[model samples]
Target: MNSPAFRIRYGFEAPECEPQLESLLAHRSVRRYSDQPVLPSLETTLKAAAQSASTSSNLQMWSAIQIERGEKRDRIADLCAKQRQVQTAPLFFAFLADHYRLASLAPDRAERLEFTEFYTMAVVDAALAAERMVCAAELAGLGICYIGELRSHPEKVREELNLPRGTFGLFGLCLGYPDPSRPADIKPRLPMNSVFFSDVYDADRGIGDYDERLSQFYREQNMGDATWTQRIQDRLGGPDMGPRASQLEDLRRTGFAKK
Candidate 1:
C-alpha cells in the first residue's frame, strides 16, 4: 500500500485496515511560532482534556503550571542547557508531580496521608496526566515537545515556579506552531514481541532486531547514528555522574526520598 503515514514511520509497507484513527499519526513537535496567540477556545478545551485523564485511586495527584511569561521561559531555557526553543515556544508547561495538593488538604498535620509518600504511584499518576496533555495538544492542532532536562536543575526550577513541598517539576512541555521547514516524526518503537509478553515473561528473544531497525530509522531521520546502545552509553556511561545522577539531594529537598 502507498500509505504515506505507515511508510513515513516504518519505511516499509503496513497493511491499511479499517479503523477511525485520529490522524494524530502525523504528529510533530513545533519549536517556532508566529506572533499570533493560541485560540482561547482551544486553550480551554486542552485544559479540560488534560484534567480528564484517569487518576490514581481517585486521589488526582498531578498539576500543571502553564507558562506565559517570557522572562520565566528565558530562565528555564538557561537552566535547560540553553535550548533556545524553550524560549521561542509560545507556551511552556511545567507538569508537576503534585502530592502536596493532597497532603495540604489533610485535616491535621499528623493525619497521616499514607498514600502520598509511596514513590511508585506518584510517578504513575503524574505520567498519565502528562500523556493526556500531549494527546490533547496534538488533537488541538498544536505541536509539543517534552523537556526531560527540566530535571537538570530541579532546585532552580522549583524556586522559579515557587513549587511547594510535595511537588516537583517532573518535566516541561513546549507548545507552538511547528516550523514547516524543520519537521519532526514519530519516534519508532520496537515490535510487539519485544515489549508485550503473554502469561510468562521471556527475555533475550530477538531483541537484536529492534536495535538494528532503530539504528536504521535514526540514520534516516537525520539524527546521526542515534542507535539505542550509543544513546544509552552517552546518557548512562560516565567516568563521573551526569546531570541526572546529581539529583539525589534535589529529590530530597523536593520532599520524596526513594528510601
Candidate 2:
C-alpha cells in the first residue's frame, strides 16, 4: 500500500509526516472482523497504554474488562442492540468509569470521596482512557469500534460484569483483525476551523462551508442519505439517540463518583 493521497490532504495538511502520523490520519472504524483472535499479549499492551494516560488529580479512576467467554460476548452484543461486531470480535473490552478503586483505598474516609459524583470530570476520565485504548489498538494494526450502545442497560451490564458499587461501564470496545472482505476509512471530521479555535472562542470562522463538505463525504461513505446537519439533527432529533438514554441515573447508582 503506497498510502492514500488522502493522507497528503489532511485536516492540518502537515507535510512533516512520520509513519505513525500517516497511520493516524488514515484511521477507520472496522465493523467486520475475521475469526482471528487478538492475542493476550496485545491486550496487555493496550491496557498498559490506557493506564499511561494522565489523570485528573492523579486519581486513576478507570478500568477495562476483557470479556473472554463467547456466550458473554453474545449477550453483550445483544445488549448493545444486536451489533454483530460485538460478538464477532474475538476480544471485547468493557471500559469503565471507575471510582471504586480510589474509594476502596480509603475505606475509612470513603464517605468523603463521595463528593466526586458531579460534573463531567469522571466522564472525561473514562473517555480519555477509552480513547487511549483506541489509539494503542490502531497503532498495533488492529481495528476498533466504540460500543456506546452498551449502556443500553447499565444496571444489567453491572450485574453481568459483577461490578461492585462505585464502578460503572461507560462503554465497550470491540476489537479484532479486520476481515478484508469489508472496508473502512477515516470518518470525516469537522473542518479545523469549525472545531479548533484560536485565541478566544470565535465560532464565526468556519460555520459556513461545513454542510456542503460534510454532505459530500456522507454521500461518498454511504452512511446515510442525510447531510451532516441533517444527520446530526436526526441523531438528537427525537428522544431516541439510543436505547441507553436511561443510563445516566444508572451510572449514579453504580457509583459514578457523583456528588
Candidate 3:
C-alpha cells in the first residue's frame, strides 16, 4: 500500500517531527558493534534511566545485572545460544523479573509473591525498564540488540548469575556503538490497520501487503524471502519450544508462577 492510502485508511495525520520520535522510528537491532567502549559514567546514566520507568503499583520489581567481560560472560553468552552480539557487545545486561528484594522486606507476606499476578507484574516492570534504557541508549547514539534466548536455558542462567529464589532472568541486552561497515536497516512493519483496532477486536483485518513488504526487505538483507505468516507458523505451530519447553518448571523452581 502507498503512504497516502495507508494514511487515509487509518485516519492518520503526520506528527510534528521531533528528534526523539525519529530515533525511535528508526530503531533497528544491531548485532555488530564497533571497537568503541561504552563509558562507565554513561552506563550509570542508563541505569538511572531504566530506574525511571513506571512500575506496577510502584512495586519496582525489576533488576539488571551487568555482565563484565570474562569467562562468566562467555559462559552466559554460550547459554544465550552463542549469539555474536551477546559475546562481543561492549555492555551486556541480564534483565530480571525480581521479587526477591520485596519478599525479603516482608517475610511474613512472602507467600503472596508466588501468585501469577505478581509474576506478570514483575515481567512487565522488567520490560518497561529495559525499553526505557534502550530509548536512552539510542538517543545517546549507541546501538542495542535484545537476546530473548536468555530464557532458553533458564536453569543454567540462574546457576551462572547466582540468582536467588524470587528472581527470574527474563532477557538479555547487548549495547555498543554500531559497526559502520555492518549496518542494519529498519525492517518493514505490518500496516497499522492490521494491528490497532477500534472499540472491539477485529480478527479479519489481516496484514495488508505486509508479507510482500517484509519479503522484499528480507531479499534486500540477503535473508531468504520468507513470508511473515510462514515464519509465525514455523516458530509457533509446533509443540516443542526447544530448550524453552521447560521454562514453566524452571520458573516454579525459581519461586514464580506457582499459581
- Best TM-score among the predictions, by candidate number: 3
Pull out the clashing pairs in model 3. Answer: none
Which consecutive 10 residues in model 3 have the weakest lDDT in total?
1-10
Segments of candidate 1 deviating more than 4 angstroms:
1-3, 17-19, 33-36, 107-117
Cα lDDT computed for each candidate against the true fold: 0.72, 0.74, 0.88
State TM-scores per candidate: 0.86, 0.87, 0.93
Candidate 3: misplaced stretches above 4 Å? Answer: 1-16
- The digit string of per-residue lDDT tens for model 2 on 92-111 reads 88988777787778888766
lDDT of 1 by residue, 78-161 (tens): 888888778888778888777687777874652343334644566677778777777887766678888888888887888898
> What is the Cα-based lDDT of residue 58 in candidate 2?
77
After the best TM-score superposition of candidate 1, give how far the Cα of residue 151 lies from its true spot, in angstroms: 0.9
Go through the candidates in order and give the clash count of each.
0, 6, 0
Deviation (Å) of 125 in candidate 1 = 1.8
Q: Which ten residues in a row have the lowest lDDT in candidate 2?
A: 3-12
What lDDT would candidate 1 get against the real structure? 0.72
